[model samples]
Target: MNDSRSRWLALAVLALAQFMVVLDVTIVNVALPAIQTDLGFSAEGLQWVVNSYTLTFGGLLLLGGRMSDILGRRRLFLIGLGLFAAASLAGGFATSEGSLIAIRAIQGIGGALLSPAALALLTVIFPAGRDRNIALGVWGALAGIGGTLGVVAGGVLVDGLGWEWIFFVNVPFAVVAILAAPAFITESRRVQGEHSNFDVAGAILGTAGLFALVGAVIRTEAAGWGSTQVLALFGSAVVLIGAFLFVEARAKDPLVPLRLFRVRGLSVSAIALALNGGAFLGMFFLTALYLQQVHGDSALEAGTHFLPMGGAAILSAVIGAQLVTRFGTRAAYLGGSAVGAVGLLLLSQAGADATFAGGLLPGLIVFGLGLPLVGVANQIAAVAEVPHEDAGAASGVITTAFQVGGALGLALISTTATTRTGDLLAAGAVQTDALAGGFERGMLIAAGLAVANLVIGAVRAPRIRPDAAMVAEASAA
Candidate 1:
């Protein structure tokens, strides 16, 4: 019993670390304008600030998690944390756009190593069953809340302090996580098979492939789909990705064991997670811009308005966790998409004349309510069958899919919103009102994607007991 208490304590610390990493993703988003103005960035290159971190982190998650299993979760945790802090300090001082983007990319590498290690460590610390469910519930809640927390805090800090404070804030989180690493969480078994070695070529190919894919998508807005540069980039992505799959199948100790994909729930949950990442996160990027650029709300005001959305996010996640524990993983997953669709439908009606009280607030709240369920339930579903040996890789696959979706989502939606707005304004529409109309159209498209998510979940939900298995694993860990 005493041992169990200690495990929970360890969970608390690990969850805090997870929160810091996830929160950084959205926190910087709210500060983008400030960072741009202070740093003097053009619109075309500005996205690299976000994309650099996301691309690296998402691209290398599988490798990081696999390393944690081989070396030591605690050791890697500290390394990743320390690297993140140092980079943050460097980034806060960055005067040139190139330097800032380079540092952010390095930050992504740190996050890739840190985030999955933290999660895999939690899997090791928590015992299986009911306790695991609760532990993971807490974990899911923290991650879901982290993005919003970062936004609000970023707003407050950027307003009072400066954009640099956003990066500066990570210093404390990284410091505390590093300090706490040695005290709690005993090292787990390293090396899955007889020999453990990283596939460097595979890693390079996969990382380069994903980066190429995302780069192509981002370039589409500038170069057009038919442009030679866009075509070559996309072609390179396809070939590299195809090579990665062939390499993984033959590698003795692949980063992601293909066998894990045989798990039904993991595959379905990951696909659903991709949709969730693409549509939901994409929605946030678009809405934040609409409120700020079109409406001209101060960053602080925009952050304040998001309080409702954040609140709804927490509520839905907690509720979804309970539902997963009570009903079933598949049910929880399907229900999340259903609820999210409703929220997106509510939000799709937003227009240029939309008021904070009448138009945007309801949709934001509704959208928030459904957001957590989409994330928490799918996560549980994905991890349930993950054998202790390959859990991290499985989690990485889920993470990779989601991050890829998120990156593409944000880039695609941003381009769509920009193009549509341009077209409407060129048609002699009111600059303000027509732009508002473009935002409305964008939200509706997001809603339509969410509806597709619902249908996919309904069709694909498999027979499984994810919560029961998750709790069992947590309690035993």
Candidate 2:
């Protein structure tokens, strides 16, 4: 293939790898009931199916990103892919819940490794210009689409085939990407030098800390925030993460370079991504509940309801890249965030009698259309200007922000909904009405988060100048 054709083909491979990883995040959700029934999972124990993956993926992401930099991106990508595929296959044959959960955790590890390497590869593959913008736009779009599509795909696969197919489905995609990757993707990593230490202690602390933190966040949905186990985990996470920061500051070569934060727009983008994650991911969770419980949609019907949102996200992501290329990341982020907040506010008005067309579609479409602008912009801002050697690290940090942010957002939103529902139920409200009331309050909080993202962008988002490589593209345009 010619160079241009090669890069685009490589992007397809990388994006496919990432799509499978992200799809796993939510694909299993629709099949949870089926898995529970077949595998004899207890009501309380069933959550581990999801939590195991979340905890490992979120915890190991930074380490995986850094490892990709230390090792080669292609090498790590393949290794992660192999691990993920194997785990998925194993999961397909799992006869017990424990075995399945174990396999899912392994899948998380694979995802943590694959996602950043795939993104880092994009940074190197496309260069810093219109091409990179478009590439990242596709990457950002898939990030949103994978989550939404997972629901639809899950419902289809589960209904048509079986729950095992969810795990089995990953193998073919993984095999194709693995076979094609060598032909298109180039191998790249940090240069070796005198200061190329790997910061073993920092890695241990950071990984454990993130694990503890994510674990605590996941538990908060089931265990109240004040529960002894949750509190202890939270405390441990704070202490360990604090120590990791301290160690990184002094290390000769840290796992996460302290200086990376000084990169223009990075810190601001990280914060914004976190808020963006909290708002939109929370919206998805609540929206799913609203569709199923209030609107009386089956799993397939609810997943179908998200099709508009998914379509809007894909369109917005393409437009967002153009906006970034023309206007800049700051402008796109601010405008997009504002639109997203409006979408959430509209969603906040849905009541028990809410119809899909009147009450849900508008918000879903607008919200979907808006946040991906932030996603595409945030992604570009986070990684575009960073030194090539740190591309993996930069991608890792950005991805971590989104995952951690999503976890935090979902926890807060779910808790709010649960509390409101409980209160309404106690006061004699019908189940559907109480559920709707709770969902409204949850969406309102999500809207508030989006507004906060807008405010942050306005206040802190820096003006990003196009690189020299982009100048020719700009002049041509």
Candidate 3:
């Protein structure tokens, strides 16, 4: 094997940054209750703590990626690291709900700037042919593994060190990454005369619009879909997003070039990302809640039990990456998503008295297997078909879709499940049993989304590894 000592070290540093960003997703899951109680957040308000970060990260991703191209990835990466670390510290020491949410939003801005630059940096460092493929595989694996670690680590920390440690954990990693990133990696190319105007108006509209849309999805429990507040928010979301789209079409230098979607792989990958994010919402958030709330498991137990799912996901993700070279991206996505759907379906049937071993473990494992396969496939697909000039935008689309879809999914399906469960209980069903029904319904929604993702994968994604094969043939020649 060719020695890649320096490259491997670089990979380690980038992967640490990647893992830190992804880990932030579920690292706070076990601490939701603690945050809610300590901060005195309303039910709807609690979702904001999570959704605010996601919305900001998702909305600004295209801008962030493009900025890195212009400002330089290495500088942007370090700056993002510093900002994220500061935001994490601010969040950790939050004395009030408003402060925490504010810091979380800033953390998201930092995340948005960091993730794409890291990936792009990796893309530049890892040469084409086997090396690039191998690097991407490692990248994908770390993303999945990091998410799993978040759940387990979050549980342990929340129980032992208190909820603040969730944010505290990132400080050291950020400091290390900020210091090390510029040392090993060389700067990548930028477009010679690319348009430089950022869509500020579009940005404001998109962010506020997304917030409104997600708010409606969350407030369904209190106001119902018909309530004036819910209706108005949804309406505002539509109008604002629509305005942003209209503005983008006319802007000289659009924040996100609309042309990226023309690539088939980019479009489908973005959709797949959305489904992937939705699945996480169901798997990590709802699943955690079911084990804790209805099943009455301790937060620690709830977090610990998710290990199987993460384990399966990591293994399957690696398998999925290998399969991509052999079978193609399409097959990996279709097969992996279907397997995950089955897992979600199985989990949807949990009862209040169900044991983890007999009831949830099998499903968790199956779902876990599906996660990595589908996730990595989607990431590979996003950047594969597009030209190098548009790689960042294409990448942005994949991640943006993931966040937007996740927020929508979590807000909508979770609200539906919660509303139905409350209604059933109000109608005289047993409280425990009704909660079970809600959890099942929510899981079913996510499962259906997964199946739909498979459909999109089969329809739009290219199966043959034309690029990989061509690289091989060229080397042989």
Candidate 4:
């Protein structure tokens, strides 16, 4: 009984930490205009505020995951929390754009460490079956809400306190999480022989490859895709990625054991997760821009506009958890994707004259409902077949897909919207109307991606039965 109590407490602590990490990804969206005004960021340069964190977070995740398994989850989790707190403090005090961007990147590294360790700990604590399913439901719910929560918090902080408060806000949460972690969470390490050494070469190759790839994608806005600089970066990324794969195939203890991909569920989940991340992140960014730029809303008002969506996401996440237990992962994901696509299509109708009630609210609620279903379902499917020792690796893969896909998707959406806006300007349209048209086009693209996710979920995601162990345990109880 005491053990169960401890597990629940540990889960609360871990979920709180996870919320902080995920919140940072979108908290800045509501504060972007403020940050840009104060920091003198060019429109293109402003993207780095978000991408710097995501790039490092995505790049180092596999390394962080393996480190957690090798060193110990508790140790890594503590270390990560400390780094994150320190970085947040630095970010709050930043005097220049370079300093803030650099600090955010460090924070991402800390997140890369903190996130997977927390997730691996969750997986270790909850035995696979009903208990794990329930715990994950709670975890996914927190994750689903965290993004919207950030928007709300960012609005309040930026409006009431200052843009810097968004960074400052993390400090208290991190301190509390760090202080409370040791008591509730137990230490865990991979049970494999102690002689297993960290794969240094694989880490370097993988991190560098991902950073370069994402950098190249972001560069396409300024440097055309066929430009010499972009071509070179792309070539380097391909080579580095190829080398990483080769090393993983040969390394005695690889950072990412390529063997894990053999699991059909994990493989499909990774692909679907990438698509979902791209669409999800792009939608938030475009919508926020639409509200602030086109509708002439304040940051606080824009944040409040998202409240309905957040509520719907929370409700759908609970239903998704139950669906996972009954029908299976595939059905939940497919159904969610179809619903999300419809929502995106509806959202594409927003224009300069559109009202929040008639134009945004309905689509926002419907999309919010489907978004959590995809997130929760993909998360469960990604790690379902992973062994205990590789739990961290699986968690890392899931998050890496999310962060990387978000970065890439944001780049695509931004580039496409900018081009369309420029074309409209050339054709003699007013700036506001052109901007709104560009945003709507981006929404349509996002809808198309959702359709692709639905197809993948239907074709690739395998149906999963409840673990026999869970059934046996229930029968005995």
Model 4 lDDT per residue over 369-455, tens place:
898677767777777777966655676677688788887777777667777887898899998899888888888888888999999
Q: Put down candidate 1 lDDT per residue, 1-477, tens digits, no spaces.
A: 239777877887787778888888888878887787889976546767887887888888878877776788887887888888899999899998999999998999898888778877886776565776677667766765786777788788888999898898989988887777777777774646733777767787988897788788777767888999989999999999899989999999888677888998788877787778777766776676677767687778777788888888877765765677888767767777777777777776767767888878988887787766666667666777778656656767887878877776666765666667777878989877766766776677677667777887788766455535563332222
State each model's CA lDDT, in order.
Answer: 0.76, 0.80, 0.79, 0.82
What does candidate 4 score on TM?
Answer: 0.91
For candidate 2, write residues 1-477 as lDDT tens digits: 239999999999999998898788767776776787789985345646765676577667877777887789899999999999999999999999889988988998899888778877887888776887677657655666787789899878887888899999999999999999999987998677633565768867876786677667656656778999999999999999999999989987776777889986778888888888888767876776678768988667777888898888878865666777788878888999999999999999999998999999999999988987887677777776789777556766776777767766766776677778878999999999999999999999899889999999998888675543442222111
RMSD of 4: 3.6
- lDDT of candidate 1? 0.76
Q: Which ten residues in a row have the lowest lDDT in candidate 4?
A: 468-477
- lDDT by residue (246-343, candidate 3, tens digit) is 98888887876678788787788888888888777756677877887788877688888988888887777556656777887788889888998999
- Candidate 3: worst 10 consecutive residues by lDDT? 468-477
Misplaced by over 4 Å in model 3 are 1-8, 129-134, 182-192, 428-431, 458-462, 466-477
What lDDT does candidate 2 reach at residue 454? 92
Runs of candidate 2 exceeding 4 Å displacement: 1-12, 29-51, 93-102, 119-141, 144-148, 180-190, 194-196, 217-227, 383-392, 465-477
TM, every model: 0.90, 0.84, 0.90, 0.91
